[model samples]
Target: MSEQALSRDRVIRTLPLTHWNQPHHDSGALASLEQGNVLFLPHLSFTLMPEELKLLDPALVAPKRKNITFDPQHNRVRGLARQQYAQQVTDLLSRYYQHCLQLIDALLPEYRHAVHSPSNTLRLHPVSTWRSKSSWRKDDSRLHVDAFPSRPIHGERILRIFNNINPHGENREWRVGEPFPVLAQRFMPHLSGYSPLSSWFQQRIGMTKSLRSRYDHMMLQLHDAMKADRKYQEQGPQVTLSLPPGSSWICFADQTPHAAMSGQFMLEQTFLLPVSAMLNPQNSPLAVLEKLMQQPLL
Candidate 1:
């Protein structure tokens, strides 16, 4: 795309806050989410206590650790130094995770019962000073949808809440691309068919946490293809999003094509919502691809 065209597309790509302020069971908010539009909460924030504020320092981050991860399933926090403040960090993240859940329940009430707890993660990270010597697949700078190589979600929707806590009032830059169905149409023909033998063998050898379904296979391939394509990375249909300090946004990461450009002091929570619980299940990435391919994905 030309500079002028890209600049014109830079308009904020988010659902209005009025939708979020609607009733807890509002269908407008749910429909917006189901359509893969981000719900931008500019006034929403995770208030940090005095002690919790210390965790935002870039020095607290461990070497080679991209983010401080809190796994509720294991009740542990990783990627942070200063064991003395581990409990505080855990508490802060736990509270943030719960905050995200409350918002999700309020905005997307239908997903309350379908949210998977064990698969969720609360993460805090600094983007400004972090650097990784990684390949394209691991690079968040490249626009791509969410897909886990080790954990196959069996077509579950990946819902995520992100809060920018930058103390210096910097913006968390991100570029979001075209719709999920548009991306699938561009790359589906290039992806290989799923092999049952390979899926079973990988699960048996513990290479994967669970059996990889056809849906998972296609998603991983599409994820890689989007990142691998240089032309698409530079000229794809997308818009830039600048999330300011104290701003929080929620979206389906698996359905939204996104790339984190730059920022610092970010708190993120991931939640898995079952496809069956969606307000419009057919609008999900799984269903979109299944319809395009004319076959059952799982």
Candidate 2:
């Protein structure tokens, strides 16, 4: 398809926030968390043809690894589907990126430069746990910002698009962790030892008296909080979005804390396509097309 033909705005403008529970704007919510402003688009359903699903089946997608776990704090079952879906996923994401860029261009024409970057892309984390259930634990998981220090804030946004390929009337919920910014701030001082600053300070001035004292105080508070709050340990914000086959949800990765639990029906599967830093100022369609026109596509 021609580049121009690919440029149609795809955002659902009527509902400012796609998901029911999301804040009207993510900036204010993120500020409450002591994080930078963020934009959240939810309940975004992408129309994927049956042929596409068939193309992504185990035979074509291939399995990369098995019994791999993602939770660092606790052990969870995980497996890599395979790199076979790499090219297919890239093509799909490229199209989705174009759709997103068109929407951005329409919404903030002046900030068009921001959308001119190649979308940072990665294949799905293969079906991590095919058919397994594990109890959630605090050491199992905790809330934190998605991006690291080095990554540019502009492209740091994450796209978590979920495609539910289940029969009609399947009851399922995506339990999101709570946004405890106050708790995060109170706990930050204690996490300092795990921070980059601690390493630098240790190298420069060995174990200083003041530093040790500060660390001790922070750890004590953190320990106390964990022990005191049973609800904080056992209870979390778990909401189920009953998505039938062909429906999807595209959400801001950092804004929402998420974990999944299987439904009553034993047979279940979900396709997740996560894209990071791909639609920023550098590698977007506008930028790439400009370069291609300068030196025609041979």
Candidate 3:
């Protein structure tokens, strides 16, 4: 086989990406994201006011939590000073979350309706200091798609918006890996069948917020399997991108395999998009896995 053919056989999937230095809601950008590519906007930014910059301190992170977060659903703030500065922090994050939603609506108008009732939050990672102490499954430095063991999503797409807020002009380093289909094929066969009994037990015991579906079970398995594989973590087909301060990017975290190598003082929002809302539903992880396994996942 030729070198290129050999590389393909080895499971390396590489594709060109257009970095948006200027905002565009055109079909091309939407098409690229549907294909599981990152919509990196080099100039798209959320500017923090002078006084708001004081929230950058790492000391604000709550004990035992990796980052500070504001959950709009409950109007609560976690991992930050909750006594004197709670309201201030909450207001800042809430505004930022709404700002992210506005960008999504403008950039991907097709998804505007699907963005409702999203479990969105604002998270500030003070530093990469938690890396060494994190467990394998919790480690963000390993290439893995987003999945939640405690929350059962039932195959909803995980769209995330990230902004690097480092005041020092540092770049958030990330290693994004192969397409969802390619990564799934490598790990799906190894995943055992899901059990209804186990799902019920976990939900009843409060181990999971809700009953885990077959789709959720498979996704968690795939997520853990990918993170635990040291060889794949080191040698997987991937590309590293440095997101400089002030820049923001958006992607379907569930469809894109990525690892945060290093960064600090970043804000992010997570939006859940139902599979039915997708322009090209077949490109979703749920759809791709269903076709490969020859069964309905959700």
> What lDDT does the true structure give each of the candidates?
0.78, 0.34, 0.78
Native-referenced Cα lDDT, model 2:
0.34
Alpha carbon deviation, residue 234, candidate 2 (Å): 2.0
lDDT of 3 by residue, 139-234 (tens): 888889999899999989898888887889889988778878888999987788999999999999999999999999999999999999898887
Q: Tell me the spans in candidate 1 whose CA falls farther than 4 Å from its real position.
A: 1-25, 118-132
Backbone clashes, each candidate: 0, 16, 1
Predicted candidate 1 versus true structure: per-residue lDDT over 1-298, tens digit per residue: 4233443223233444333234454477678777777777787766788777777776666777767788876778888767887898888887877776677666766777888853333334544344255577888888899998989999999998888887788899988787787789999878888899999999999999999999999999999999999999898888878899878888899998888888878888888888989888999999999999999999
TM-score per prediction, in order, is 0.90, 0.44, 0.90
Worst 10 residues of 2 by lDDT: 4-13
